[model samples]
Each structure stands twice: as C-alpha cells, then as structure tokens.
Target: MSDEKYRETIIEQAKKDQSAGKFQSESPGFRSLVKSYVSVVSPDRKNIITEGLTAIYKNKNPQPKTLNLIDYLLGNVKYCKEASDVSYAEFYDSNGEMVASYSNGKWISYGTKAENARESELWGIYNEAWNNAARTSQKNSYVAGTDTTIGLMDISV
Candidate 1:
C-alpha cells in the first residue's frame, strides 16, 4: 500500500480502537500504536506530529544535543585525521576553496554563499556528513534510551 494510504488506515484503526476502548489513554498499547503511526510518517510530517504530541503529552525527557558541523566532522572517521589534537579545524573542497572552519568551538563558513556554514551548501560534503551523523546519533540514542530488557533466562532451566 502507498505510505499515505497506510498512514490513513492506521489513523482510522486508532480512532476505532479509541472509541471501543481497546487501549486506554497513556497506556503502553496506546504509546505503541502512536509509534506505529509515527514510523510511517515522512520526516517533515514527523516533526509536526511530534510537536503536536509534545503539546498533548508534555514529554519531560531532555532533548538530545547534536554537535555542530565542525564539531561533528572533527570526530568523524573521514575528517578526524585532518585536524586531530588541534584547537582548529578547516574543511576544503576538492577545488581547494576553504568551505568552513572550527576554532575554539565556533564555526565559520567562508565565501558569499551563506551567512553561516549550517545555512549553506557551500560547506558541501562536510555539511552532508554532519547531517547524516547527527541523524544516526539521534536514532541510536532514542533506541538506546527506550529499550528495556525484561529478564534474563535461567541457565539451569
């Protein structure tokens, strides 16, 4: 089924479940159902959905912090060797133009393309890398934070 259609189906089912009292509000089943709906949503829509849910649920968890582009790249496998142990780090395109730099926790983007590296694609590969890394980090942290192990098996059994 199309993603939109699947999402609609899940919503309809959720409505039915709610009216029939199949799952109580704030119950584990309700949260699981919400997660199912959220999983199929597109990225932009997910943000809007999350905002609405946050308003309703008033989530109290602290938000995960993402590293800035320069900070992210400095520790990244591909770029780390270039600036290890230095207080400064700079990214350059294949054409030898300076794209961005990190100094004393500040990021500066070169050229007229953008007021900042985060706002400009002129940072190119570095920007993409940082975005991918940040997204992965967020996903990993979410999974790690939410996962629970119920119990261990008895080896004697």
Candidate 2:
C-alpha cells in the first residue's frame, strides 16, 4: 500500500480506538507542561516536535511511561546529565535500601516497589522540588536592601 493509504488506515484505526476506549486524551495540564518544556529547555524544541510527530505518525503513545511529571523531568535531566560514561554515586535510605545517586548531572532512585517505581509522579515531584529550589536560589541572588526600594507617595495635606 502507498504511504498515504497506510496513514489513512492508521488514522481510521486511531479514531476507532478512541471510540472504543483503547486510547485516551491527555489532560490540559499535561499538554501545557509539555508545551512549556519545549518552549524553554529543548534545543530548537526539536525534542517536543519529534515526540509529537512520533505520536501522530508512528502511533507511538505520548505517555510512554507511567511516571508523573516531576519524575519525567528528573529522568530527562538524568539522561542528559549522565550520558553513559559514568554512573552516579550510590546512596541508601534510612532503611539501608538504595534510594538515590548523582552522576554526571543526573539523579537516580530505587523505589519501594515496581508499581511505585519511577513514573510521572516522580516527574511531578521532581519538578516541584526543583522549582522550589530554583526559587530559593533566585531569591538568594537579591542583594539585601539594594535589590528593592520602597517608594512612598507624598500625601496631600
């Protein structure tokens, strides 16, 4: 079959899948998150475009894993930071279970169970935590009294 015909067939199948609950729609928040990430971090935003095209053309699921938003961000950071040459330094939790490691520029963690493993939840948490950290860092950049000045308007007598 021709490429056009194949694409048409896939679209039809996707429509059917949607009707049959074989597919799902992403939440607005998720879409916004993706858009924001693409707009900000991705070089040329090609990663976002490539992912979108993959889902549309190759029928790849946009939600590749069950991870939460923060976890996803952390994972991406991990992948980018850790390349492949070096592994993170291992660390364990209070219970002696290995939890997190930092290598290159990534963080790794082993969760309690497979079901509770790295997922979008992790991504969400990571994002939240990272944001908070970033905010603190930004705040620290303020020069005590020099960064801000209080202005008072003269009151009419």
Candidate 3:
C-alpha cells in the first residue's frame, strides 16, 4: 500500500476507536486480568498433622499409650477430586534426586524409581506410591511451601 493510504487507514481506525470510546490501556491490573495461560504451582504446601484417636487404658494401667506414626498423616489420605489431572509434586533432596511426589496439601513424600510407578495411568502403581510417600512425608517432616498452580481451564483468548 502507498504511504498516504496506509496513514489514512490508521487515522480512520483511530477516529473510529475514539468515537466509540473503546480503546484499551496498558495498566498493570488489566495485564493481570488478562494473563497468558500459564500454569503456576499452587502456593499451598504445608505439613498438617491430625491427631490420631487416643486409646484409654481405663482402670489404673499407667495412663494410655500412643501407637504408630504421628496422627497427622495416618489413614486420612485424601485424593484430589481430579486426581488423574494431578502431577507429582517435586522437591530437591540432599542427594539431588528429582524426588517427584504427592502430598496431603501439607507434608510431601518422594516416589519410587520403578517403571510402573513412574508411568501415568489411572490408579497406577506410581500414583499410589507417590500419594503414600507424600502422606508419610507429611507425617514425618515439616510442611514445605509451594507456589505451583496447575491450569485446569482457560478463559483467555
């Protein structure tokens, strides 16, 4: 196109936009409102231990005794509503292993190196192992903070 014609077209479009009062601005909040679809790690990672049921010795048997690991992460394993879409959480270890994992929304544990455990499948051995490890780890260690967010749906065009 000729320079004059291109300039005219630009001017025409600008006038139309101005008349309609429909121009966009470069504001930070606007940028955040229409962000590119990017997966972010959820920021909720902490070890939450629930107390296990206490046993009463009754009579005079020198008070009651505790059983098993801490009550925090036992038998209270909860699966995300969409567990299939969940990926293993990751953490660095002293040995520098990738240490992919699962968690109780709190504590985390590492998965196995077995081929099946590493593969993806519904209720796959690996998935189960990771879940177990995460729960166990949560029971044993302090909860770590995470900022990972998975993209479950997209609204941006």
TM-score of each: 0.22, 0.20, 0.16
Every model's Cα RMSD, please?
23.8, 23.0, 26.7
Best by lDDT: 1
Task: State the C-alpha lDDT per candidate.
Answer: 0.40, 0.38, 0.31
Cα lDDT of candidate 2 equals 0.38
By lDDT, is 1 or 2 better? 1
In the range 1-157, model 3's lDDT, one tens digit per residue, is: 4435533443444334333443323333222322211102111122211211111112122322332344222322222223233222333222233333344454454432332231222123323433555555565544332211222223332
Tens-digit lDDT track for model 2 on 9-115?
A: 43444444333434213334333433443233223223433342332333233332343565334232111112223333443322334445556656544443321
Better of 1 and 3 by TM-score: 1
Model 3 alpha-carbon miss at residue 52, Å: 61
Please give the ranking of all candidate structures by TM-score, highest first, separated by commas. Answer: 1, 2, 3
- Looking at model 1, report the run of 10 residues with the lowest lDDT sum: 75-84
From the highest lDDT down, the ranking of the candidates is: 1, 2, 3
Q: List the residue pairs that clash in candidate 1.
A: none
Model 3 residue runs over 4 Å out of place are 24-157
